[model samples]
Target: MKSSEVTSLSPPPFSQVLSMPTSNQGWPEDFGFQLGGTGPSYILSVEEGSSAHLAGLQAGDQVLEIEGHNVSTLGPQAVIAIAQTQKNIPPSIGVVSRIQQV
Candidate 1:
């Protein structure tokens, strides 16, 4: 994907979205961005068939928000925790800043 081709998309939630694959990190099967780096949590990669990838999330995109809150201050754990609390993976929105060219 080209960096110049960033797209802001709200991918439709699929029926497969569930807590079937729970991560040891306390996240469900919905959001699949690997968190890491120096300061803020940056998207390392998006799983090919994950809900996050289907939602237009890309590797290198800066995670700006989780749900309706800006997690830049609260951090990714707090954001991820929200997803962990749901029985059924609820619809959560992520605001990422990246332009993909794929």
Candidate 2:
């Protein structure tokens, strides 16, 4: 899909949201862009000050995988799994997403 046509998908369902962190990175003048990338099933938002943010995730970057695990296929279920089990995701964790200029 064209980048403009690719609407940013909503976060994983609310039930699974709590499993992920709640920290909010400061609001940017314009949030960076992310196009629901691929890999394992887990995807997450990096809170402004949280470690995830420092690693480079913007508001819409998709957590396509952790280590080598696939995240795009598992969807919300996979995200919960990562949030619950992994605490120190690498800075490269979100590279799979096909982010675009906003």
All candidates: CA RMSD (Å):
12.0, 16.3
Candidate 1 similarity to native, TM-score: 0.54
lDDT score of model 2?
0.42
lDDT of 1: 0.60
- Candidate 2 scores a C-alpha RMSD against the true structure in Å of 16.3
lDDT of 2 at 91: 17
Pairs of colliding residues, candidate 1: 2-101, 5-99, 5-100, 6-99, 6-100
Question: Residue by residue across 1-102, what tens digits does model 2's lDDT show?
Answer: 655656688867643222233321211211222222244332245456444554566654555655555655555444444534553422125444545778
- Report lDDT per candidate: 0.60, 0.42
Q: Looking at candidate 2, what is the lDDT of residue 61?
A: 52
How does candidate 2 fare on TM-score?
Answer: 0.42
Worst 10 residues of 2 by lDDT: 24-33
